[model samples]
Target: MGTLEDLTDALARDVIAAMDEIGDDRFFEKVSKLLLDMSPTTQEAYMTAIRVRLAERRARKYVEDALHAARAAKAKAPE
Candidate 1:
């Protein structure tokens, strides 16, 4: 429904602003509370999406870490 989509987008924007203001220490807490406030089906769907996003983040971080390590090794190698 349009109303549901509007509410979801509004909530996402507000939560993002709140997360920025609150900082990392409480960001997960804020999200967790948001999920807990939702219906079971909504919470499950949100959690699934969150998991996918987090996995993508981890994959990107792993690549970045590997590249950094390779650069460090190349810099330190015999030259």
Candidate 2:
């Protein structure tokens, strides 16, 4: 079985991706329902965790894009 951390990461990533695709009103409804049912502490913890995961995802994408651009430039350079 996957660890708790692994499960959390996967679920959060999936939620973030879905939010990206959904309209604002639908996203607000779904997320508000999910979080509003939680206790205050639980809500804070989940928000913190998702924010961390999103930051990591953005950083990874930035690095990957930079590397790809550098590699393409290198390939096009004269030997």
* Top-scoring candidate (TM-score): 2
Model 1 CA deviation exceeding 4 Å by range: 1-21, 24-38
lDDT of all predictions: 0.62, 0.66
- Candidate 1 lDDT at 31 equals 69
Q: What is the alpha-carbon lDDT for the whole of candidate 1?
A: 0.62
lDDT of 1 by residue, 1-79 (tens): 4654455445555555575686753464456567778666555544454455556767999999999999999999998
What is the number of backbone collisions in each predicted candidate, taken in the order shown? 0, 0
Q: For this target, which candidate reaches the highest lDDT against the unseen true structure?
A: 2
Tell me the tens digit of each residue's lDDT in model 2 across 1-79: 3454465556566677787787342453465357658655444555555778768978999999999999999999999
State each model's C-alpha RMSD to the native: 4.2, 4.1
